[model samples]
Target: MSNFAESRADLESYISARVPLISIRSIEQDRALRLVREMAANPRRGNLPLWIYTRATGTRDLRTNAPTSDDRSWPGAMDFAATQFANRPQSTVVFVDPDDLSDDNSASRHVAELARLADANAGSIILITDNPLWSGLQRLGMSITLSLPDASEMYDVIHAFLTDHRGVVPIEWNEQDARRAAEFLVGVPEGTAINVLATIVTKGSVQRDDVEHLARFKDKHFGDLAGLERVEVAPDSQQVGGMTSLRAWLDRKHQLMKSDLRGTKLRPPRGVLLVGVPGCGKSLSAKAIAGQWRLPLYRLDLAAMLGQYVGQSEGRLREALDAADRIAPCVLWIDEIEKGLAGQNDSTGVGRRLVGQFLYWLQESRSRVFVVATSNDVRSLPPELLRKGRFDELFFVDLPDSDDRQEIIQLYYQRYVQREPTAELLDKLVGLSDGFAGSDIESALHDVGAELHLNAGAELRPEFVVEAFANTMPLSRTNPEQIDEIRTWGRERAVPAGRPPTSTMSGPQHAGRRVVVLSD
Candidate 1:
């Protein structure tokens, strides 16, 4: 059944059962009111008279679309509702912004009294508001949530807007583009989506680029709501020197990840967890995946979600995850995931609850939000996160192997030097920088560039790069125990990101390198 149809049926059943007080929580107040009006006029509902109340409009008979009396205040409205119930016992009264009653003790009592009267008289009082803030009414009524429109509803919204604008402005969209646009608009309200579509087509015509424009629109509107920062990934940033296994897996699932597989039994690819040494391109892999897939990227800051008030943290988390689902077919990059989830054993139990909520969403959410979580300290992570079904795969991104180092060196050289490195230089640097992470390689190359800049007319040479490598200390040498521990854990639990090291280069080059203690 359609979502609206199902909701209508459920609401009808509640009314038929004489549910006295029904609280509807929704941002779409207009839509909810319209549905309520329709239900009031339905023959199955006994054509009950519909009364509506708002702070601005006071109390009005919806059937007549006219103001009933001067009792616009909360207490006055309660008295008016009572009078109506006494006269017509089978009526429905809807209060808009009833959350206002939460702040007024007298109004709250009046609401409670009205609820009791409605129960005895077979009338109904519906409270409609964006937030479910009527705590006092909780035991007296049942709450129904009206979610933002889904993809299909969004598509219909687009179609209706296009039909409305027919011949007024040029419209260019195929079924595929329309579907994609709907996906891009998923987490937005129907009203906002219509306004966005209208604004896009206002210039001249709606092009395929409108899909990306919709993404930006969502980022601007919804990104800040849930402690998520929309990361703007450049198209040229897809290059990564290694992670052959992860790259291959992503390539295989790229199409399925973006496609709408609602009817099919196959679930979309969840994501990957990259646990390894820091500066080993774990975070880089996330950016590369989003760029490669041509999807939007968002960084979730779990630390920012902590709230001082009870349930606030969980509320923020729920909002963030819901936003992620709304902006689906995108990559959610959670860097240093262990830091976010490390407090699972804290005394307050907030950490445990947060972890539980995140895991539940990760497992149950069918949205196309592919999560790419990178962690430097795997030991700090809970075992529940490492379970098989949590992510598509767990990858171990150790220090680059020889071939990976060679490619990384060449890539950096070409990028920084504006020219490819000679094969001899590449081979020597690959051997000399053994156990160096990708960041270490880039640092060495950057130092070489700095040297060349200092000597304005000097020719760039391979020996200059070798000198820089020798002078720098890689993390492996400085934190051998930690690296060894991480590698040991990865060996048994995760797939290697690159092929096994095959170089036999003996490394006295790293000898006498300063041991800089680093913290993860």
Candidate 2:
């Protein structure tokens, strides 16, 4: 059913044909054996069955060459090899030592032995090795590289291995359960993951519960993203909101990264940057994007990532990215896009180089991981991150106007009401909370609850909420030019998140209402 299996099946059909050599790679050797058998029995009429001239370099004597440690015995391999060789005496045979091939004497001796075998067998010969063997294989002219396990085939091989060799009870231990668990914890430590899985499934019967346990395991049991990833400047985007256009752009990126995609129709977006005001919803939007896309999120913390020690930060970042890729289809949320890697040209070249490496991986990668980067300042970003194809689109989440304000307020009020909020009151609160960002609205809502608690008679009503809202200073006013500069920078180069408008501002300020913004 998988691409690898389908591909391997096709490859099997060519095993005995004019194909120079065939290579089957997988950690699941049992399933690989099954594939060899099926390939050897291709049903094509008037066509010869597949024949593999597998030859070994180890001692050929039955007693001396016998394997000592594992069931993958030389005897077993020899038996299999003999069976095939007997069936096709003139089949091509390739032999390369698994050990050192650098010593000219050893190399020449091995090559001579393979040549003798090929002559006696009346078949072509090839060599496989790391360095010296490369020359040997090349001298032979016809050879194939042993490819690593493919993802699609990997699960099947593993499941088959579990069933065949590990006393797997198919009814008790199904392939679906094993595959699902493996997919869920792909990056978990091998030992820990196995133990956790054993504990879950053995909870004794149906595989459904085991799957749920994997789903609910918290950050502590599983590896922590904060501990695993790096960060950079692109001011965080969680606070940003009302970016309908931006969300749409990311949605397209999601489709591009779908697992079902294949063969060139699937081109994922390179990356995306969030341009927004200081206290706007840019950071919040990035976090919400994870929820929207139904993906795991890894926040890259540059401050936590960079180390005073040489080469450490970069090494850590590489490991982090590897982890992300191994757990593909996750969201990488990088906060404070500007400051995170802006100093690359000067004293921070090492840090800049690290960002360069990240960008490099970003460009060449073909996985489903989505990158959501938020920034308050754009001038600090490297030219590379801003390069034409780097991101799908650059969205600017400016300050909230009337409609957005209403959404923010309605969200907070509905959250507090523990039910739906009154529509009229929602509109009034939205107007009273003009200029207040999502964060500011949340703060004001909290303040209103505090105000209600401080006074026994007054319930936390819209009027009191407006009073609470009026008491706080919006971040735009609190930090004057800081937020404005951000907005100005994004004027045209960036797409707007859509404004809620200022005419709503013409109405009288709410009675006893005060606007406020929280400060660091």
lDDT of 1 by residue, 246-279 (tens): 7787888897776777688888789999988889
Count of clashes, each model: 0, 40
At residue 404, what lDDT does model 1 achieve?
86
Model 1 stretches astray by more than 4 angstroms: 1-3, 41-46, 55-59, 64-80, 119-121, 133-136, 234-236, 301-329, 343-354, 454-458, 478-482, 499-520
- Poorest 10 consecutive residues of model 2 by lDDT? 45-54
Q: What lDDT does model 1 reach?
A: 0.82
Query: Across residues 113-222, which tens digit of lDDT does each residue of candidate 2 receive?
Result: 45444445443333334343434434433333333333344455446545543434323456555555455554444444545655654544335545435533523454
lDDT of 2 at 482: 83
Question: lDDT, candidate 2, residue 162?
Answer: 55
Q: What are the lDDT scores of the predictions, listed in order?
A: 0.82, 0.57
Task: Give the distance in Å from residue 274's predicted Cα in candidate 2 to where it truly belongs.
Answer: 0.6
Who wins the TM-score comparison? 1
